[model samples]
Target: MAAFNLTPSDPSTFILNGIPGLEAAHIWISIPFSTFYVISLLGNFTILFVVSKEQTLHKPMFQLLCMLALTDIGMSSCVVPKALCIFWFRSKGITVDGCLTQLFFFNTAMTVESAILVTMAFDRYIAICDPLRYATILTNAQIAKLGLLGLIRAVLLVLPEPLLLRRLPFCPNRVIPHTYCEHMAVVKMSCGDTRVNRTYGLVTTFVVIMLDLTLIGLSYGLIIRAVLRISSKKAHRKALNTCTAHVCVMLMFYTPFLFSTLTHRYGQYIAAHVHILLANLYLLVPPMLNPIIYGVKTKELRDKVGKYTCRM
Candidate 1:
């Protein structure tokens, strides 16, 4: 192999390690990963298509669901195909600019997804607690504004990452031990002082996760209080039932995300493959499961999906 003439200022390319200590198993790992990707594509696209065609489903809640589906598609698409290529073809080289682009889109999808979850929680809260005003508050115009704001917020939050990265001097060792261009993973390859990069990354994570979780929790707290005031047990069950899918989806997204984040930052004692696997799962599992959670818990969507499948 010829010597790699890499410059700290403008490194030509970085190699992605599919999974450290598991190179022999990359093909095996891609099996499940590819399965998840396919399921995510089918499930989320089905949600988008069904919701779009069904007139009765034209509402704030379903509109938000479509947004979530878009993000799910984006999140999985951002990483999975590239990962599959690495596993199957041993094609791991990624240019610095390409890596930065991937990092931006991946993080933007993640942040926007968080925002959408918070919006979904609020939607449930309003529908249950203030049914009369739900339509007024979450109007079509309002929903459009919310979606625009979410995209704007996501862009602003992630835009700094690529900019910060460009200024850094990367080390000669340009291999990242993961499937995709995760923000921190790319940052670690830099030989320059990375305090700003790390600090900003943590700040973005805190803003997206902690702030969103607090809002979701508050929405549910009010929802519970409102539900309790309903004297009938049947009414209580009915009110809570609507939120079950959202809650399940929330858990599916955050649990793995928190675990992966903490493990990456603090779990040095853990095995490398374990960290890589969880990181991949953090991106894969939620998208694959979100539509299924909604389909099983939501009667209208389920019926529509069944009818649509029968026609095809």
Candidate 2:
């Protein structure tokens, strides 16, 4: 066992972690991940292309969908490329600076995705529950404003994570257990007191997930009530149908997220890896499903995407 000194007087050193003696590292993981990455990229790109080419999709709902696609593209690109490199080349080494950069962008993109989903829910709520005010309430200007706010929130939330991590004194172990640089993963490697970082992380998690979940619940609750108030059975069914896809996406996106956070904190090593897997699902599943979900569920989007593709 080796001990690392963490003092200004001594030179800094880092310890890398890996299996003690593995003859051949496995390469199989990259196959599925790479396939998923390609599909994710093509899927998200198609959504962006469809939305951009169709002038009719220039509404608030589609605008938010476009933003969601962008966020998913960024999230997958940030993690999967590096992960594939590691798995294919058997090169797990990463510079401290590189690690920090990875954490920053990953965090930012993930935060932005969460915010965009919430905004999308709000857009849907207004469209269904308050049809008369939908146009005025979610004007193009307002949609742009929401997008801008998502960007700003992402930037602001991540600024403190790196700043906080940079200040922590590191243990010699430089290797992260998982593939990517998660905020809590880095924080746990610190030799110094990490109470502040943990507190901040918890607070941010609550603000992002709990608050967003509460709002989503409220928005849907109102939507359900609105649906019930519609006297016509056909109209009620249609309104509920419009929300079905969104509800599915929301459950898939948030349930895994919450489970990951909770299990990662208190569960065993295997549990932690399962949580990591779930977290990846959050990034990949919603993006892959969004366009398909919206396409089948919303006739407007399906028709618009079809018309735009026909022009090509």
For model 2, what is the alpha-carbon lDDT of residue 202?
80
**lDDT tens string, model 1, 174-282?**
8899999998899889999999999998888987899999999999999999999999999999999999999999998898888887777788999989999989987
The 10-residue segment of model 1 with minimum total lDDT is 1-10
Report the lDDT of model 1 for residue 300. Answer: 90
List the lowest-lDDT window of 10 residues for candidate 2: 14-23
Every candidate's lDDT:
0.91, 0.74
- Backbone clashes counted, model 1: 0
Clashing pairs in 2: none
Tens digit of lDDT per residue, candidate 2, span 1-312? 122232222224222222213214436556667777777787778878887877777888888878878888888787777666656664556566677888889888878888887887888799898899999999989989988998898889887988898889887656566667777877887889999998888888778888878888888889888888889999988888877877887777777777777666666654544566666666667667766787788788778767767978
Q: Measured by TM-score, how close is model 2 to the native structure?
A: 0.88
